[model samples]
Target: MTAVPAVALRGVTKRFGASVAVEPTDLDVSDGEFFSILGPSGCGKTTIMRMIAGFESPTAGTIALDGRDVVGVPTRRRDLNMLFQSYALFPHLSVEDNVAFELRTQRVPRAELRERVAAALDLVQLGEYRGRKPQELSGGQRQRVALARAVVGRPKVVLLDEPLGALDQRLRKDMQFELKRMQRELGITFVYVTHDQEEALTMSDRIAVMSRGRVLQVGSPTEIYDEPANRFVASFIGTCNLLDATATGGVVRVEGVGAVPAVGATDGDVVVAIRPERIRLLPADAPGGIPGRVVEHAFLGDHWLAKVVVGAAVAPMQVQVPAAEGARLLRGIEDGAEVALDWSAADARVLPAEPAASSTRTQEVAA
Candidate 1:
């Protein structure tokens, strides 16, 4: 028999008085997969999460969990657990008590509750700190306690809403790996929500990128980063260099880079996007290259970020190179020094110019 999806949202919509918080959104999360909803604040990522958690009702459409409709189920009845951004730990309760609170509420036998709480603490590697109160634990420890509490019930799916947002940079990175390990061991679906692109890239098996309550695209990390669906996705996910080009017979004429044939482009104006690392810098007198002027350079530990002025464009094009290689290239070079830039046609992506109607259409649709 085919296993049902862990969670499925079919044309789900949510409205808050005058605002439509989540537009008609459809998504399916597979069993035991770590899926993420990624977007900026006010993009309705949380609203979708709330609907899945059964904390909020959809104004339209249906939601299913393991093939059973859960639209009207209350939060407590749904076989799902959520770890909020705030740890939400009880300050007065010890780590063990915090993890056992759910069991006590269900009136489980005291012996069983104690065993479950101990096992939960052990799962999070907090067994030694079971006696410590939330106020006595470190930030990461408290977050782990919260995670243990959520998983103690062994729910079908686990929802994490920016669960590591409060931790420091190093701790956050550490927890990303820990969470992935825990999810794999538990064999449960994980639906994570985050606005941080790096967090989404590192943790998720697949990410649904949203904007204004609409999902722009869904793909693996490499696909989303390397082959974005449109200009917004390309620009938002990472740093990209864009050039205005006119297409003629499948060839794009970049102002300084000359005409180059590209895939999926015909006769019209298009935007060419390439990553900084893909650009190659050469001396001004080097053959077969486009002309530019060095405007600024900054050494960033392992790499150097160089800004180069090309043609009438105001924003300088940025290129990243290894620090050692950059040092060699910058020898005797100074501000306003002419330079040559070159990149293969295969390195650039030709996209159609965004229609003005899209801006108005998105607004109207959102309205």
Candidate 2:
């Protein structure tokens, strides 16, 4: 038998006044899965989360939780918990009391409430600090307290809204793993909202990419990063070199780059998206490749980034070289030095020239 999705949105949309915050969209998050809604601010990712939480009524369509329609449910009536970015722990309450707040409101028996509160604090490693107030804890500790409070009632779903946004880079990284671990231990579905690509990529089992109040694409991290759905996804997920080209008879021709193999391409204008690490830099006079001048280079911790301007292309192509290879390969290749760029034709994706144009029919090219 097919299990019902933990959270389902069918043709869901939201509008505020005359402005549409979310377009018609469909999404299903599996039970016990870690799913992320990723997009820039105002892209409607948070709006979708709010609607699902019953805090905002959708302008259209229906929302379901475990096969039951929840479109008109009140926020408190939904079988879920929400953790905000601010932590929101009461300054006057001790850690244990904060975690017990929900159970107390439900009037759970004292024995069970105490046991549940202790377990929640232990799960978050705050059992030893249960006597301390929110103001007595560090930023990370306070965040943990808020998380414990959210999950203490054992909600079937947890909605996290950029909860780690205020932490330092290192702390944020630490919490990412912590959050994933907690989710697995509890075996509850997590629908996280964030604008940070790295956070989404690192923790989510699947991600929904949103843009301009629409869901652009949804897929696993590898699929989202390596096989983007369109131009916007290609550029938004990572640093890519997008070059305009003309495809004709199984080949794409870039200005001054000659014809590159593009099998199954329909003759028309297209844009090629390739990762920096895929482009191999070579001596300008070497056999076959695009000739260009290295305009700049920067030394990153483990690698180097070089920008090369080629042909009639509008922008320079970024190339990533390993630290060891960079030291030897770029020994005397100073600014303005001529170089050649080459890559396996199969490494590049041929997308439509227009921004956000769907490329479901697009295929990988080969020599």
Candidate 3:
């Protein structure tokens, strides 16, 4: 931890005439760590990547690479590489040529260029595709070629802006494992930008949740998901059931559901946030439980995702039942069938009410 950070930003801000794309912010990416800047569209995630890649200059503040300020450095001189969502490979060049283009431009020796390009392609398991042009490869294979090109120079940090966004779900998942493996083996710092919450949670060592051109919270994946800093983070990082309620001593009382265990809030309006998987279905009319009815259900492979409307809950709360357990309980679980729901008090967290938004802007709870 004592080593100089691979990348650092101090009071970084970007202004595009009248629009502020990124607010003043401070960030430090540790050496060899997989760090992700996660947020929805237009939340400044891509602007952050552009700033780091030297494509866009910040209106204020400094950007340092390996502790050395590089505000005026051109992209080629900065010793950093950017991988875009588009492959951007030269159609005129073969895969090997595409991967070797950067090194060749740098005037690297022929033998060393060949060695580095081969090593990079091998790292991504694309050695055999070297002779084929990018137009001949599948989306996933072309992505690997782009990945190989990015790392052939062995930059200290690599900026990836939704490089896998174009692939299908199955291919994207497969690429995630391959990309993580490459990052670990190369021991390079990764500055990844993505809007996909699950991708960030699965691939990043640490994540910075951004919103409204500002950083809401920065922490490890577990901390960001389990102990989100605010309501924005709580609702954004995963699927959460947000229940509006009034907080009393050690509990939040719901209008129709009764008292619910809660903490860290005063005697006023608050919210209780719980994940879907943590809730359990109890026998109808069970003691210390809230009564509800199943209004909808869906089959999601390993588990059944169902929405239960409890009298005390402000809206239909989602519940996840294991396939085996769901089979036994689903006989009594149908549209309009009676049921009861209960969850561990520790599983539910108290959070502040959402901040009021400007009427002109679209209101959304995103993940």
In angstroms, what RMSD does candidate 2 have relative to the true structure? Answer: 5.4
Model 1 lDDT-worst window of ten = 355-364
Q: Which stretches in model 3 have alpha-carbon errors above 4 Å? A: 312-314, 356-367
Better of 1 and 2 by TM-score: 2
Please give the ranking of all candidate structures by TM-score, highest first, separated by commas.
2, 3, 1
Residue 329 displacement in candidate 2 (angstroms): 1.2
> What digit string (tens of lDDT, one per residue) describes model 1 on residues 1-367?
8778989899998777666677788999999999999988877899899999988899999999998899999988889999998989999998999999998988989998888888889889999999999999889999999999998888999999999999999999999988988888878899999999988999899999887777888999988887877777777788988777888878778775677435667788887777899888888898877788999987888988889988766688888887788888875678888988888777788876772112212332221
lDDT of 1: 0.85
Question: What is the per-residue lDDT of model 3 for residues 71-109, given as tens digits with 9 covering 90 to 100?
Answer: 989988887898989979999999999999999988999
User: lDDT at 27 for candidate 3?
Assistant: 98
Q: After superposition, which runs of candidate 2 have C-alpha atoms over 4 Å from their true positions?
A: 261-264, 357-367
Error of 1 at 34 (Å): 1.1
Candidate 2 backbone collisions, by pair: none
* Cα lDDT, model 3, residue 356: 24
Model 2, span 95-208: residue lDDT tens? 999999999999999999999999999999999999999888999999999999999998989999999998999999999999999989999899999999999999999999
RMSD of 3: 2.7
Question: Could you tally the backbone clashes for each prediction?
Answer: 0, 0, 1
